[model samples]
Target: MSKNGSHFKVLFRPKAETFRGGCGECQTSCQSACKTSCTVGNQSCER
Candidate 1:
């Protein structure tokens, strides 16, 4: 269980970094729409 948890954390670390970096820009460009899409798992801005 611990091993799986560690692997999952590692797998998502880059995504977290990308989100931190891109989220600001997304918010600047799209405002509330970006936040809504992100929370809803749309990931349209991730492209």
Candidate 2:
């Protein structure tokens, strides 16, 4: 994750870097990833 992306994780899903909900609840980068898969954990990033 980038410097700012990490911050978003802290503010949003601090426990996990993967998708916790939908685009609205994820970070900007995560929002994009959620459409496919999260690069961080390579998990299903969809809602």
Q: List the residue pairs that clash in candidate 1.
A: none
Predictions in order: lDDT: 0.50, 0.51
Instruction: At residue 15, give the lDDT of candidate 1.
Output: 65
Please list the residue runs of candidate 1 whose C-alpha ends up more than 4 Å from where it truly belongs after superposition.
2-9, 15-17, 23-42
Can you give the TM-score per candidate against the true fold?
0.21, 0.20
Cα-based lDDT at residue 30, candidate 1: 41
Worst 10 residues of 2 by lDDT: 10-19
User: Residue-wise lDDT of candidate 1 within 1-47, one digit each (tens)?
Assistant: 36556544343445666565554345343446656665545444633
lDDT tens string, model 2, 1-47?
66666633444545453335455644355556557765546444343
Clashes of 2: 0
Candidate 1's error at 22, in angstroms? 2.9
